[model samples]
Target chain A: MKTKQELKEILDFIARYATYQLGSGVHTSRAVRNSRRIGEALGVDVQLSSFQKSTVLTVLDPESGEALTRVAAIPALPISFERNSDLSALSWEALDEGLALDEIRRRYRTLVDKPRMDPIFTLAVVGLANASFCRLFGGDWTAVGIVFTATLVGYAVKQRMQAHGVNHFLLFAGSAFVASLCATAALRFDCTAEIALATSPLFLVPGVPLINGVIDIVEGHVLMGVSRLVNAMLLIVCIAAGLSVTLLMVKDSLL
Target chain B: MIVTDMLLDGLFAAVAAIGFGAISDPPMRALPRIALLAAAGHALRFCLMRHAGADIASASFVAALVIGMGSLWLGRGIRCPMTCLYIPALLPMVPGVYAYRTVFSLIMFLQSLDRADGGVRYMQQFFLNATVSLSVIALLAAGATLPIFVFRRRAFSMTRRK
Candidate 1:
């Protein structure tokens, strides 16, 4: 019932919204299910699947959950949004131009059915979560602050990173080291653990990947979801490795 | 871990849900709505966890299901994705920690029992305890969503269910 162009707009909106979850490691299948929900709202039956890269998506009608005859592309721009961003640049009214309401609705359905193509949001989220471990454990403010640092670094580099890519791992590792590097000092010098516990919020910061991972697993993409999760788990392992090294290096300093 | 004990643990689960929502739609304005849902969800999960124990997963899953029903019922005008709204409010409650502890402690128990040390039996007891705890957590989650399910038909009619 919807036009191809309207579907494109809807998919673009889905992609824009998805970046938020990707940064938290929540998973993307939520996006798929989410798209389906949106499709239902528009009175259409559609499903979306993301490729390993690019904004290209494989869309299908929900009755069969198979790919539509054609592939559509949405600009994958949110991978590089600034820390605590405002999306005023992406005005809803902007999409209203040159398209009729019924036509817009049709395209929107098709668009919402497209899969997300980027993993930077996913990669960055895992980094933020790993950096939060110390804070979540009731550590100091420094632990929390470091989460912010990781967020900045991850946000800065996510666009350039890839799924299961070397830089993705590096960004996560770097964030872990930097966050814990500061945390190590705080653990020794910043006084009691409770005094620093408030800082955990800094670490608790960020959310995209957490959402993506959950969505993926819940939607039943066992391997792809697990791989993303495993990749995140590896980042945590590396963080622990880095933290252990920090602990080993600084062991004699505190007592 | 005591800091995250019981009710707080449950409350934080809702936080995870919000975090999940924020992740999917970064600029989503419905975060505060999620906050409220998290509170409602935590309260429901608390009642169920406090009672049925093992059904916690079923309860929470029901919470998620009710959330879907609620969205369709109440969020008619605002244009929110129901899954995006509902899932995050439930994110903080997933039983990963229990699963982690169960599997980890189980491995240790099996190791101890295999070595035939006196600690083996103790480890076995711990394994049982962990398993029971995991079941309890799941049941609580499942049961908590019960009220939502019953009330969901009428529950959705009142207001914006974001």
Candidate 2:
């Protein structure tokens, strides 16, 4: 029922949607699966290839044997599980109800533009989580208080650096340095400085990427897995570099 | 005293998972499940370490396996991706202390490079800490994802359904 040009436009939008999902940190197979589901719903066949920083998607009209291929360079975006869930749900709806292309496009646009969580709320939760880690590791009330404040300050710095579009490595390093430095206050106050220092930067650990890297390798996406693992290792090194400065400065006192 | 400690640890793990779930911006509906999974995993690990004398790597592996299976089941029940449930839940088991110690010892080793006795000790400590940290991370990933592979057909069918 649709002309070739209109179908091409739909395929392009689907490719962009797939690229966005990939960029937002969904696993390769899931991204591919979701994109194919949407394409099939609209009566097309989809093929996807993902690399470290970009994705290639092709949609084919089986009846006419016409194909449209799109290569999108995905700029990094902060991972949001909320958006991933919403998009997946949207694709399912399209498949079940046979939604029109215009309606699907409008829904996709709204999903992408959904407001993110409040920055203040994010800072507070990260701080609380880190502080909880301190307690779980046996820090006393005073140490928990110190770690809470330290994480709050550190996470705020991280948020600010991200807002300014600073380099990722530097942002992590700076946040770690600030966190460890502030955690020293626990020592000054006779609290458990060791626990505070160890836990304050727990929030900065890239748990998702580390897990995703292993999953990718296990699932046979070796190149993507290796890249993700290397990136995570580099970030860990940056975090250590930042924490090392604080440790060196306060070496004598702590020792 | 041990029982109380384990209970407290589980409670903290749940709270930490909730906070992390919020920070990651998962759907509000998913937070409770994340908290429950985290608490369950952390408690399981703590029990293994305290009662069975399991090493950090083995304990983390078992705990992560539990969390992974739980995530799959829960994700299917809730009709969302398994990752939305698992990543935040697994945060509590990340071995932060070992990682920090690995870095600290490595730095000390580098600084004492010219020294004979202390440098060797620092170097040994660095290797020990790094080995433990890396092993735990590796095991965590392997154990958590093993179920997905084992139950591949079920996983695929569940996700593919309308």
| TM score of chain A per candidate | 0.46, 0.96
Point to the candidate with the largest TM-score: 2
Error of 2 at B161 (Å): 7.2
Writing each residue's lDDT as its tens digit, candidate 1 over B25-136 gives 4334555666566656655655565656736555666555555455444334444434335545654554433433333344445445646474566466556656664454
Model 2 scores a C-alpha lDDT of: 0.85
Clashes of each: 69, 0
lDDT of 1 by residue, A1-255 (tens): 445665555555545544433432323554444444444454445555554232234444454333333344333333321111221111122232433435544554454444442345544543444333333334445644554454445344433443335454565555444544554445544544322222222222222333344445545666555655555456545544444444445444532
Give candidate 2 regions above 4 Å deviation: B157-162
For residue B27, what is the lDDT in candidate 1? 32
TM-scores of all candidate predictions against the true structure: 0.47, 0.96
lDDT of 2 by residue, A114-225 (tens): 9989989888888888889999888899999999999999999999999899999999999999999999898788777888888887788887788888888888888888
**What is candidate 2's TM-score for chain B alone?**
0.92
Root-mean-square deviation of every model: 9.6, 1.6
Candidate 1 docks with a DockQ of 0.11
Model 1 CA RMSD to the hidden true structure, in angstroms: 9.6
iRMSD for every model: 9.5, 1.7
Q: Measured with DockQ on alpha carbons, how good is candidate 2?
A: 0.67
